[model samples]
Target chain A: MAVEITVKGEVMTALLSGEIDHHSAAGMREKIDSAIDSNMPSLLVLDFGGVSFMDSSGIGLVMGRYRTLQKLGANLHITGASPQIEKVMKLAGMNRLATIN
Target chain B: MKIVNKFNMSLYARSANEGFARSCISAFASQLDPTLEELNDIKTAVSEAVTNCIVHAYKEKLGKIYITAEIIEGGILRIKIRDTGCGIENIELALTPLYTTVGGERAGLGFAVMQSFMDSIKVSSKVGKGTTVTMKKKISPRITVNG
Candidate 1:
């Protein structure tokens, strides 16, 4: 899996690609967290357009990021998630934690 | 249900193998000509089962994870994932949604996801012996239009 970070104004977007499982989630979390720590953006956007597959690990990844951003008093937005990915997120009650589109 | 085709594979219980297990099952289930959603549901269920083996069963140690996939009668697919590692002490508590023993790192949704995606799931484990997760899903038959 790969995570690409792009910043615009107060928004930091992390574009994620490839299959996300337990092994890959750690790296993605690290990259996103480091960016959040360094830039401290007012909003963090996770782009899942390129992600082909995901499981509950994807839910954990999003939950962890939400917690991290919450501590920093930043907002979180998830975009480009396919219907399948969105279903898993919704099953985990992720919609209550962040804005999903 | 009668089995049409089946395959067995064994791999080390590593997080990286989660994808491998999913691919193997997906390829095997493809013979059923499942819809995209059906195929994805099977793959997702397989991923969750394998992840449980790697995370909860084996923990920090490496162990073998055995997977079996069978295409049954009437376009039904059955997958069994077995791990000979530390088994669950309480299956009831483990199956609860959003319950994880590993603290904040894991979402504890593995079994929940499997149960949701598969038509039915059966889990049996012995504290020291190991754990096995068997899941089944029926792929609806698609009607093709003749040209």
Candidate 2:
């Protein structure tokens, strides 16, 4: 998977692409978490426009990040999730915790 | 149990191999001409089963994971994932949603996801021996046949 981060004012958007499974979750988490810790952006956007496939592991990734951002008093926004990916997130009850766009 | 088709293979229990295992199963299942949703469900179930072997069973140690898929009568796909590694001591606890031994490292939803996606699941294991997860899904035929 490829992850790209861009900062705009107080927002940091993480553009993630490719399949997300257990193999990539931990590494992806570290990369995204470190960026959030250092930048402390007010809003963190997880853009899934490029993501092609994602399994339940993706839910854990989103949940872990939500906690990290919450600790830093930052909000999480999920955007561009394909319909299939959106259903997985919703089934995992992620919509209750983060803003899905 | 009459099977029309079957495939089985074993691969190393490496994190990198999880995707490979799942895609392989998905492609093989495509022979049944399952709907896209059914294909996704099968892929997700395979992912969870193989991931369990890599993460909990072997804990990064080199091990072998076996996968067997069968196309039973009526387009029922049955997949069995086996691993010869450390087995779960408490099967009940492990299947509980939100219960994880690795703390925050995992979401503890692997079994839940498998159970959700597959029509039936049977798990057998012995401490220090290994664990075997068998999941079955009924593939809804997308094309109807008229005689």
True contacts kept of 2: 0.54
TM-score of chain A of each: 0.96, 0.96
For model 1, residues B103-142, the per-residue Cα lDDT tens digits are 7579999989999989999999999999999999989899
What's the TM-score of each model vs. the native?
Answer: 0.98, 0.94
Every candidate's chain B TM-score: 0.97, 0.95
- Supply the TM-score for candidate 1: 0.98
Question: Which residues of candidate 2, in runs, are more than 4 Å off?
Answer: B144-147
Worst 10 residues of 1 chain B by lDDT: B98-107
Q: After TM-score superposition, what is the CA distance of residue A53 in candidate 1 from its true location, in Å?
A: 0.6
Pairs of residues clashing in candidate 2: none
Local distance difference test, each candidate? 0.91, 0.89
A1-101, model 2: which lDDT tens digit per residue?
97889999899999999899998878778889888878889999999999978887899999988888888898999999987678678767889999898
